[model samples]
Target: MDYRKIREAIIEETSRTHVHLVEVLGDTITTRLLKDFPEVSQVKLRISKPAAFSDCDAVGIEFLVHR
Candidate 1:
């Protein structure tokens, strides 16, 4: 798997977003990966908002994408 490409895409897309929702970010990353990498039939993304809460460890979302 070309992890470097995937990471670059995710970073490029997610870094300049007005909507900071984890679900949206996850979906965007998955879509980008699927489009860029045909070998990736499925993508699983986990986002953790570590600074969102003071008491809890983190609040995040997980998403799965399938072609």
Candidate 2:
């Protein structure tokens, strides 16, 4: 599949799951992507949202997955 298709699939699946946690979302994506692309042995995902405080731009979480 192409990059566009892979991206669309990820977005669709993530929305369907209705999961809010960054860690869970990263893990879920890693698992699903790895199934289709065995050459990918690692996935590094980062999620950021508007900062709760006025000090910075955003707050985020990063998850690294290895198979």
Candidate 3:
């Protein structure tokens, strides 16, 4: 996603283009949240910033499986 400007300009030039790190953190947090609260089965996360007219930082991801 670092060089995602080749296709979608909006995704590369938006104030909320943090799906990368957002989802990663989402998965992590989701795992923890699930552990603490088993009632919730779904989690969605989003992170955004202001950088280069769009704003974004490196993103990492992780997911957890509940059994």
Per-model TM-score, in order, reads 0.85, 0.70, 0.36
Q: Which 10-residue window of candidate 3 scores lowest in summed lDDT?
A: 1-10
lDDT of 2 by residue, 1-67 (tens): 4777668768976888677676677777778877877777877778776864599998788878788
Pick the winner on lDDT between candidates 2 and 3. Answer: 2
Give the per-residue lDDT digits (tens) of candidate 3, residues 1-67: 2224322433433333444555554555555555555565654434443353434653334454554
Model 1 spans with C-alpha error above 4 angstroms: none
> Sorted on TM-score, highest at the top, how do the candidates line up?
1, 2, 3
Q: Please say which candidate is ahead in TM-score: 1 or 2.
A: 1
Alpha-carbon lDDT, every model: 0.85, 0.76, 0.45
RMSD of each: 1.3, 2.2, 12.2
Write down the TM-score for model 2.
0.70
lDDT of 1 by residue, 1-67 (tens): 8789888888898887676577887887888889999999998888898969888989999888789
